[model samples]
Target: MRDRLRATLALVVVGLLAAACSTGGGDKGFTGTRLETPYQAADIALTDTSGLPFSLVEDTDKPLTLVFFGYTHCPDFCPLVLNNIAAGINMLDDDESAKVDVVLVTTDPTRDDEKAMRAYLDGYNKSFIGLTGDLDTVIEVGEPLHVYVNDGKKLPSGGYDLGGHSTFTLGLDDSAEAVALWNQETSAKEFAADIRTLLTDD
Candidate 1:
């Protein structure tokens, strides 16, 4: 399963590179990879940590939205990405911060209930929104974004390993169209700089 996930990720990376080239180097000023073709935000209706229906498009009031697909149980990737984003937001001015909304959609909903999701996200940023729902619903939400989500190999203890999921953090504009993506390796400084660029452009 790990091998298959790696292959899929490799293909995704190749595709992103090809798209970047074909698009004549999209939005060169941004630190993240600009999309060749923007993606309209998925019309998602998921339960937030507060047990309220959260509509990705309608609920977000910010001009810029950062959407990430991950689970709370992830040992390294999830925390790293969330923390960096949180730190990046902290670097912005109050007005700039208010223009951005960070959202996390759990890939493993079986264990990531509303309570658990809220607790996990609070450790990073209290303002960060976490969404969880039925596994099928979660998969459907990720499909249009090209963020793959799948269960991992089982362990001898009857538990499973970390789930397979895409690591890109998508950047969405006011129109709810995805404009860019950041990989797991992007630093907090890079995130802040790119966000500032977006805000200025807007």
Candidate 2:
């Protein structure tokens, strides 16, 4: 069953990327063998939209996170992904909902400073935190998560395009650990269900 789920998930990743692969924490409770599954999440570092230091290490005590990377300037996909996440969170039971977090790690640090992030996130989910830091530091953060961004140039037409990048969504457990070999790449509806399961374990 787990193997079949993994296969389904692999295909989902491929499809999202072709469509342009697109697209938390805090302690509550639960001691069930964490990560009793097949996959686990990666650790990373970034700053929240408020410029708050968002070190993954610090969150080891918090519930796991659903991590996604992209820039705010992202034309369409970024917003859709974020809105989808917001929709998922809305489905959670109020109590279980407090155990998880959604993270937006920005690729366009040049423009996505604390003030910018805070403003951008206000439009959608207030629970969401956007993060950015120094270019080198941001690059380092993306490495472990396998997120990439290609050189972008200002177009004569005004806006620019993402030169190179891969969209990915990652989930982590409440112990600040990545859920082992779990299914990702789910829709807002599907994601909400997975989140509910994780919250129950918490």
Candidate 3:
């Protein structure tokens, strides 16, 4: 299965370059995982910070939809990834940057209530959208993307234990399909460049 997926992704990358070149240049590659076969957006929906229904489909108009799954209480990677995204957005031209949507979904939904989630993401960028709801919904939304979310154990203190989750960011194309992925090690500049390519590419 893994090998097949990789092979499919190789084809996806080639198609993207060929398709993108017709629109413009310098969009032939990216610093992230460019799949040969695009990932179809799943049918999962969750509650946004504003208590409204939220899904990647809602941001399909945007050239790119970046999704990350982690808990608000996460000690390191979560905040770092969000910060990288914010920095990446800053690297884009105003109009191109505006066309990107960053969505962070809570793996620990039980503890990451709307208020907490909003506050946490707001610290990174006011434009960031935070989503939280039942754990099952979160899992369903992340499953297709290979984002695992484990509800953490309880601790002696009122706080919960650290949770385990995938740390890669899934990048969705204009039609709301995931076509690329970037890990925590990816820099803001790299992400911004890839996003710009997606926007300008046909």
Candidate 4:
């Protein structure tokens, strides 16, 4: 099931990218893929790293929000994406950085309780917000964004592998609508560039 969802997502991304390219996306001046129809940010309440109720649209004060869905145990993509975003934000001026918010909603809530989520996110950027709650709630929140989340294959060590999930970082505007999508392969430089463009447009 997870594999099928991932394949479907890949195809969708390819189609979006192709459409953007054919339309001369250069006019947008964004390094990330601009969504033809933006997704309204989910307003559901979830527990933040601080163990307090948080609403993505209400709690975030920034004009631009970058949200990602991944688990702490993800062996590769999660850390890499977080690190790149952190680095990208660091490239901006103090005022510019302050205008953006980074959010990570864990896909593996079974192990990513409030405390664990906070600790893992601090390793990349202390300012980044980490959120975790019931797995069902997580899936519900991700639905509008086309983010796939599911338990992974069990392992022999009495543990399990990282869960399957989407790797795109969604860029949401102050209106709580996702305006762009950054893939895992996007470099820190590209992130910085797109962030600047988004901020300027906002």
List model 3 lDDT by residue over 1-202, tens digit each: 7544644564455345434423233435677766656767776779889988887776456778898887788787788888899999988888887888898888777788889989998899888889888877877777766554532344343333323325678888877778877767778888888887767766
lDDT of 1: 0.79
Give the alpha-carbon lDDT of every model.
0.79, 0.58, 0.73, 0.78
TM-score preference between candidates 3 and 4, better one: 4
Alpha-carbon deviation at 130 in model 3, angstroms: 0.5
Give the range of the ten consecutive residues with the poorest summed lDDT in model 4.
156-165
| Model 2 stretches astray by more than 4 angstroms | 1-45, 150-165, 180-185
Residue 97 of model 1, lDDT score: 96
TM-score of 2: 0.68
**Residue 196 deviation, candidate 2, in Å?**
1.3
RMSD of 4: 3.7
Ranking by lDDT: 1, 4, 3, 2
- Taking every candidate in turn, the Cα RMSD to the unseen true structure, in Å, is 3.2, 9.0, 7.4, 3.7
Ranking by TM-score: 1, 4, 3, 2
Off by over 4 Å in 1: 1-23, 26-29, 151-165
Question: 105-177 in candidate 1: lDDT tens per residue?
Answer: 9877778889999999999999899998886787777767776554443434332333333677888888887
Cα lDDT tens digits for candidate 4, 27-82: 46566777777878788888998889887778876899999988788788789899
Clashes of 1: 0
